[model samples]
Structure formats: C-alpha cells, structure tokens
Target: MRDTGYSLRNAGCSLLPVRWGLFAVAILILAAPVAASGPTNPPNPTTVILVVGAPGQDEFGRVFAESARLWLQACEKGHAQSIAIG
Candidate 1:
C-alpha cells in the first residue's frame, strides 16, 4: 500500500468520463425548451389588410395601430402587421 502525493492531487481532479461532467450540464440546458414553466402569455392577434385606393391609407393606419396596440398591450407589435399601402 503506497500513499503518494500524486494520488492525492489526482483525487482532487475529475477522473469520471468527460461526458458525465460539465458537458452533460450544457447539453441539458440546451435540450430544455425556452418557453416558461407556466402557461404562456399567448401570442398577439395581428391583422394584415391589403390596401389599393389612396383614401384608405389613413384609415388602415389608424385601425392597425389602434387595434394592435389595444389587444396586445404588453406584447411586441410589428409594423408589417399593422399597415401597408400599395
């Protein structure tokens, strides 16, 4: 039975498989879903309307900004969903 300083140092370090180490932790984190644990806030209901005449441009803008702002108060609103005139 030999008790050596090398054995003591080796005991302090990791001898188990590398996969069972920090790599496994990272794999678990990446594999986990990003969504929250509880029920989600629900996606905002966005509306898109195609415009033709010039008069409706103003109206479309108003409706898009208003409804989108109203329904999805805390959510991120996209300009593309709001208004587009052609």
Candidate 2:
C-alpha cells in the first residue's frame, strides 16, 4: 500500500483530546441542575409606568385613552402595578 501520509490511527490520536474536552463540558452542563437545586427567593412584582402623550386632536386623544385602558387591563392580568399619566 502507498503511504498517503494520512491514516486512521493518526486522525484518531489528534481527535482524542478534543473528544475528552467535549465530554468534560457535557458532564458539567448535565450537573448544573443539581448545583442549582437550592433554596431560592420569589421574585418581586414588576411595575409598569404608562405615559400618554398630549394628543393634537380629539380623535388622537380617544386613541390614546383606549391604549392606556388596554395597557391597564394587561397590567392587572399580569399582577403588576401600573401608573398611567397623561
């Protein structure tokens, strides 16, 4: 057989270290859940501040009011505090 300067043994040897490194990383990723299984505090509620701009026309004012109402409804649904300012 002609020596092609490339063989399975040489390729496998070069990749062995990389394979081991990847295996170690996989092990760490799998173990993260176990490390995170500790007592945790509940997160604080979020507050949303909705600012309505001055509408140039009556129609724009109505639209802004409706938008604010919708945002208030969503905040209530999400159990978040909301402050609406025009």
Candidate 3:
C-alpha cells in the first residue's frame, strides 16, 4: 500500500484558500476611501449647453425640441447657472 494521504500536491492546493482570502482583504482596504465618500454633486455655476437641429425640418426637429425641453427643466431646477440654446 502506498502513502497517498497529504501529498505535496494536496498541500500546495490548501494554500489557495489563504491566497484568495488575502487578495480579498487587500481589495477591500484599497476600496475603503471610495466607499467612505458619498456621491458628489456637480460644481456650481455650471453651464448647460442645449444644441438643437433646425425646427420645421423633419422628425429630427421633434427630437431636438424634446431634448431642449428637458434641458430647460434641468436648468430651472438650479442644475445650471446659464444655458446656451442653439
């Protein structure tokens, strides 16, 4: 009968779990700073640009109009200090 129990190959595989645990800990430590900080709001005095295609042209004009309307709402909500509509 051969001594097949606790071979060197099996010993090497046993270290896999420890290596993965250490890797997980390192990742959490590196991500601590980003996780601690909450979401950040955009800077004040933001300039909002609304570019629109020429009206009364085609279906694209309708899309541009809708986009412009949404941007106007954002601007009114204090999301931007000024808007340049073109």
Off by over 4 Å in 1: 1-3, 8-20, 29-41, 54-86
User: Against the hidden reference, what TM-scores do the models get?
Assistant: 0.25, 0.50, 0.47
- What are the per-residue Cα lDDT tens digits for candidate 2 across 1-86? 79999876877667778899999999999999988897775664799999999999999999999999999999999888999888
- How many residue pairs clash (N, CA or C atoms closer than 3 angstroms) in each of the candidate models, in the order given? 0, 0, 0
Q: Give the alpha carbon lDDT tens digit for every residue of 22-86 in model 3.
A: 99999999999998997888578677777675777778788887878877888879767656557
Q: Residue 12 in candidate 2 has what lDDT? A: 65
lDDT for every model? 0.57, 0.90, 0.79
Off by over 4 Å in 3: 1-13, 44-46, 49-74, 83-86
- Write candidate 1's Cα lDDT for 17-78 as tens digits: 65587788887787676533656766556665544343358887677666555644433345
* Error of model 2, residue 26, in angstroms: 22
Off by over 4 Å in 2: 1-43
- Candidate 1: lDDT of 30? 76
Total clashes, candidate 3?
0
lDDT of 2: 0.90
